[model samples]
Target: MSTIVSARGLTKKYGDFTAVDGIDFEIQEGECFGFLGPNGAGKTTTVRMIHCVSPVTAGTLTVDGSAAGVDNRALKKKTGVIPQEITLDIDLTVYENLLVFARFFDIPKREAKARIAELLKFVELETRRDSKIDQLSTGMKRRLLVARALLNKPRIIIADEPTTGLDPQARHLIWQRLRQLKAQGVTLILTTQYMEEAQQLCDRLVVMHQGKILKAGDPRGLIESEIGKDVVEIRMPPDRDEELLARLGPLACGHERVGDTLYFYCRDGIGLWKALVDLDLPNTVHRPATLEDVFLKLTGRSLIE
Candidate 1:
């Protein structure tokens, strides 16, 4: 796959505070590339530059062979954005909301009508087409947002926290639609705080922190590299951590104590489990290491705010 978006030493600043600081990354065509981070971590800012709405403070940023800038109308024409916020007009029916958006792309009334019908069905909001935006459920509204983004038949789609307030069933439905679009060869750029969302949709991703890239790789690869195959949690008192580590630390690759739990990351979990059982420790859990483990390990377990 060819590079669809590339950034070298990219920087974004508002006044003296920098949001993105000299980060470099590349996005491949027809892949779901994700930007994962905590709140105010510049994931949104980086994608904003990619979509050409926010200007780069300094750096070489290019999308589809053209330099990215706020004035790049040609680039904007082929890019679709599913914003984090629900920006639909409450007074308009779902169909009218899409109609107004389609007009922005200069799509003719006849073509817009045809495209809107197709998109509504694709998002499973066909029955809600004439329903007012305010009358729809949160899931229905989010699905409508997905349809609105596709009006331009874009080559690239940016989804920023697309399933913020959605339930499991609703979120999965959106995921299916996104996967369908990607299978059709649309390049997907996603920014999200949900680790499951990233693992589900992204073929590859970059984890951002304080305007910098901490790690970049496929979800499973990152999990394996940063955290081993299994994790053991012993919810003993903090004072007993040293005693427990002394007994089981050699079997695990690494250990950390957070709150009342001592976490053991290991490739050889069987040995670790056996050791814990021999010790007859209570409140012990051995589980598979996941993307969330890698995320917290890199980003720190503390609240970002």
Candidate 2:
């Protein structure tokens, strides 16, 4: 696929403070590209620059062959944004909210009406079209936001934490719609804290921390590369670290102690599992390595705040 978004040494700053510290990455066309990080890790800052909302303080960012900047109307016209916040007009009905947004893109009223009808059905909100925003549930509001973003028929869609504050059913509905868009060849740029969301939607992604890209790869590939195949967590007292390490450490590729648990990372857990069983240790959990494990291992398990 062709590159839709490209950044090199991209940086963002607010006076004396830098939010995005010279990161570089590329997003391919028709693929769901994700930015994953903790709060204040510059994920939002980076996407804001990509969508041309925030100005770049340094380096270069180009989207669809044009330089990304605040004044780039052509770029803006081709991009749609699903903001992290619920920015819907509460006083307006669901259909009205999309109607006003279509006007901003200069979409003709007749065409806008046709598109709105299709979008409401696309997002499964057809029955609630005349309902006020306050009458819709959180999930319905989010679905409407998705439909609103589509009014312009954007080539690229930027979704910042799109499923935030949603239950599983609601979140899955958004995911299905996003996947459908990807299938139809819309380039998706996503920034989310949910690891499962990233794993589900992203064709490729980068993990950012402290204003920098720490790792970038396919989800499963990154997990295997950074965290091996299996993880065994033993929730024993911290003092048992030496005893556990002396017996099981050699069978595992890596080991770490956090809080009251001893984590063993290995390519194959059969040996580690047997060793643990022999030792008959209590509170032991052996499971497959996941994207979350890689994330925590790279970013540290401690709270970012």
Q: What's model 2's TM-score? A: 0.98
Q: How accurate is candidate 1 locally (lDDT)?
A: 0.94
Worst 10 residues of 2 by lDDT: 236-245
TM-score of each: 0.98, 0.98
lDDT of 1 by residue, 142-245 (tens): 99999999999999999999999999999999999999999999999999999999999999999999999999999999998999999999988888777888
Q: What is candidate 1's CA lDDT for residue 194?
A: 95
Q: Model 2: per-residue lDDT, tens digit, 1-305?
A: 89999999999989988899999999999999999999999999999998888899999999999999999989989999999999999989999999999999999999999999999999999999899999999999999999999999999999999999999999999999999999999999999999999999999999999999999999999998999999999998888788889999999999988888889999999999999999987799999998899899989898997
C-alpha lDDT score of every prediction, in listed order? 0.94, 0.94
Tell me the deviation in Å of residue 259 in model 2.
Answer: 0.5
Q: How many steric overlaps are in each model, in order?
A: 0, 0
